[model samples]
Target: MTAQATTSEPAASEPARRKTAIPKNPGRRDLGLRATLLFPNREIVERYYVPVIYTACRTCYSEQDPDEIFRRALAGDFDSLKMQKLIGSVIESGHGSTIEHVVFTFAISGVSRTLSHQLVRHRAGVAFDQQSQRYVKFKGAATMLPHSIAEGDPDLRTRYEEQVDGALGLYGDMLQAGVPGEDARFIFPNATRTNLVMTANLRALIHMSGLRLCTMAQWEIRRLFQLIRHEIFSVSPFLGSFLAPKCVPLGYCDEFNNRDGHCPIRPHKDRVLEAWAEKAAAARAAGRELPVT
Candidate 1:
């Protein structure tokens, strides 16, 4: 009898292999997205935001009470540059609690439900109030057309649009047929538009921006963060500067998908470690220990 053949197929419970290629940087395009800074305009941010964070940082080292430190900061008792420098250093040092004392509220609109789902996943130090599909039945509901599909083959684009429109038309028909709005909304696609009011502390904002600004992020969410960064910059460039890709501050890209170094914002961690190893090896060969920082 012939021996039974062996197979290398993956087990049924095993997860599918994920794509490794980092997505292309979706350069800013008009998606009709808007991110408006609703609270703490320029004057409020300038007058209070910095001082609030500064007081949090200074209170750590100073014997002075936080209220007194905040008062001094507000009264211009500390040199503006010096205060900013200290705040920057503390933030760089990963003393995140200091920055958590301040928060920014934004009115985000015209973003896809897909993006909103990702956005709400950030829960720490962030609060979100989103438009409800169940409570507010959408009339002539708007949907987002992804840049790729919008610019793809003419026939493909029409097909995509027609499918989405058909679903929306069915949703309306279901509603008219006495179906609950919640049930009708089951037909809505991820491309459906959503609005949210998000208020996040500086620490959470920085962390979220770091992730969503990365090239590996979905294009719609990346574009949302871009608009968010722009809004923050309009009020405070110093604060906005902190909202960058995680790799920018980490000094090395740690994304597993970026092993090919496709995103050029920074070198991959593996390469950085490899270079360090090589330097240490050369030092050892030369009968000298590599100095550690």
Candidate 2:
């Protein structure tokens, strides 16, 4: 029997072997370069957020109030470089709402359903639309073979294929057997991945990117964000530049697990606080005062 044919298993069965494979031509199977910016086109960006957000940062310091600032910014009364500098500083200071006014929509294609499931967990500041398993019968559905499976033991990898194929086989059988698609879908594994389209405002995109960009985020999701970041950079490098790991903005790592400081992204927030406290104590002992932000 064909290795593919022999490797099938029931939905409840575990893999016959423990090996996982990384695809030989990984790039061929890669969810390569997914996510296309669909709306709020470049014209909209040059006409709107670039100026609007710039105005938001400048208004506070300028003698002119926000209305006047916005008018002048849109009217090209100020240099983009000066405006960007102020926006950069204000954003760094945690003024997030000013950047929230602009949004980006991406046509995210070729991601696994697995990635999409974890992605939608983010409730605030984002939106999503996925390829519906119910609406789409998936006559020619595709599946992802994880890198682990690709690079595993041959025997173990064979077993893994069998399990995935068997699950897909049962799904097809159930569909042909008149079982409802929803119920038949119980056989689908987390690996039975799918695709989606997602959208977010600059605030949300940056926020989500921050969380998922962390080392703690799942690898697949991290890779996906890297692609998303690339897409943003293609259009407006200025806006795209904001998408980054959360620690980049925080100036230090805050994750509790980093107490040992292994992640190395930044000094732990606790450690920094403790150092500040120690300095304060020393100052008090010396009859001096610690300056506060």
Candidate 3:
């Protein structure tokens, strides 16, 4: 007979692990970051957006030509609800190209250089044109003051503000003393505000939003996505509804940073996998096979 291995749980006297601290919500701020949808206004989205995406989806399975499918979709020959259902099904099944047919253009402004550095990391199916520091000499450059610093010890906050102002002041001094704008910009801090015109396909937008909208993302970028979601909702709530943290669609959180389960929005994937393993082992001990999903 084969011997079975067993494991014991931690002793009752063992100290409980300390829970990770959850980040405090950053309250509303006048922070100038704004995301404005620059293309496909409501009329265009209502009239042709769905049909265009539906055409892309249906083209894969139907014998009909793609343009004919789009024409019928636009003419209301196909049921609107049914088209949405099909599109949703295709999206959930990981058929990303179906949604890539649609794209959004956004005028992003007043964001810090810090956020821009992170934002540009997303290079797939996206394009960005940023306000050039070398070409555009900023007469008045703004900076971001994070909520934590603004609301912390008063002296510390004052020092932080003064430091930022001094950097901008030095930048201006350099420019006035015949320094090239490009050379003067060397004094700009990461908090310096910048502008960008970003264009991304639906697939890439969703993927970027999934990472940026999560509770674990940097506060400033998370807020930016919140505004982006609002802009999308203004054009088409049906499409905007799809933008959410990646875990919302995956049914479990995969972020290694959330392994301690502090966020509480969803169970960590590691815990879920461990639970399944335990269940399978118990089933085997009973001489029965556990079913896999």
Residue 271 Cα positional deviation in candidate 1, in Å, after optimal superposition: 0.3
What are the TM-scores, per candidate, against the unseen true structure? 0.91, 0.80, 0.90
Residue pairs with backbone overlap in model 1: none
Identify the superior model by lDDT, candidate 1 or candidate 3: 1
Ranking by TM-score: 1, 3, 2
**Candidate 2: what lDDT?**
0.75
In model 3, the runs with Cα more than 4 Å from the true position are: 1-24
Give stretches of model 1 more than 4 Å off.
1-23
Residue 291 CA displacement from its true place in model 3, Å: 1.2
Using TM-score as the measure, which candidate wins? Answer: 1
Q: For model 3, where is the 10-residue window of minimal lDDT?
A: 1-10
**Candidate 2, after superposition: displacement of residue 32 in Å?**
4.2
For each candidate in the order shown, give its overall lDDT on alpha carbons: 0.88, 0.75, 0.87
**Regions of model 2 farther than 4 Å from truth:** 1-33, 56-71, 277-290
Q: Which candidate is the best by lDDT?
A: 1
Q: Name the lDDT value of residue 218 in candidate 3.
A: 90
